[model samples]
Target: MELGRLLLLQVFCAALDAGTTWLMWSRIDISVVLARIAGAFLAAILIVLFCRRAPEFRGIGRFLATSISLTCLLVSYGIFALLMLRNPVLQWPLAFAAASGASLLLSWIGYWRARQGRVSG
Candidate 1:
């Protein structure tokens, strides 16, 4: 896929995840909701940056990529939120950065696997 389309997909996924997170958890605390939303965006951007042509994997692989992306977003936000609960100070940036880094690492691995020529599609 083209870069623009890939980015649009990421933004769409991030926005959907953020909207859902806000609707579900915004009642808890405004900060947590916003942080998780930001984390979701960061995960997509960082994943794209590290993964590059990761979206090229197609067929059923395309669905798997999207599923993994969503899963990673949730997991990354959950980890950041849990860590923030313990510190509750100036750790939001650090936690989000780490989460983005983790997402990047995960995407890089996926990109590697996608290029291994073993996947069906």
Candidate 2:
């Protein structure tokens, strides 16, 4: 897949995830857009690193992945905030964990499908 198309896909996924997080949370955080954009950028960098396109930038790719991961955590936190609104005194650590886990599962499914297409093509 072309890098440009991959980046677009990443942005699309991030945007959809962020939008869902907003709807689920009942509040919009402007920063989530920035985070999503940053996440997409970092995802591109991570791809380059993971694919071994640049050995010197491996550390940078790691940093980018860490940054994107942190942003993803924040996105999960936003979703958790939305989920907790239904119950005032609910502890959110577990909810966030579950949400993150679900998101990861979905991502893995999408990644698997994408890889299959690439391999079969």
Q: Which candidate is the best by TM-score?
A: 1
How do the residues 35-98 of candidate 2 rate in per-residue lDDT, one tens digit apiece? 3444445544554444354233222333443334445445554565566666556654455456
RMSD (Å) of each candidate, 1 decimal:
7.1, 11.1
What count of clashes does model 2 give? 1
- Candidate 2 collision pairs: 25-82
Model 2 spans > 4 angstroms off: 1-78
In order, what lDDT does every prediction score? 0.57, 0.46
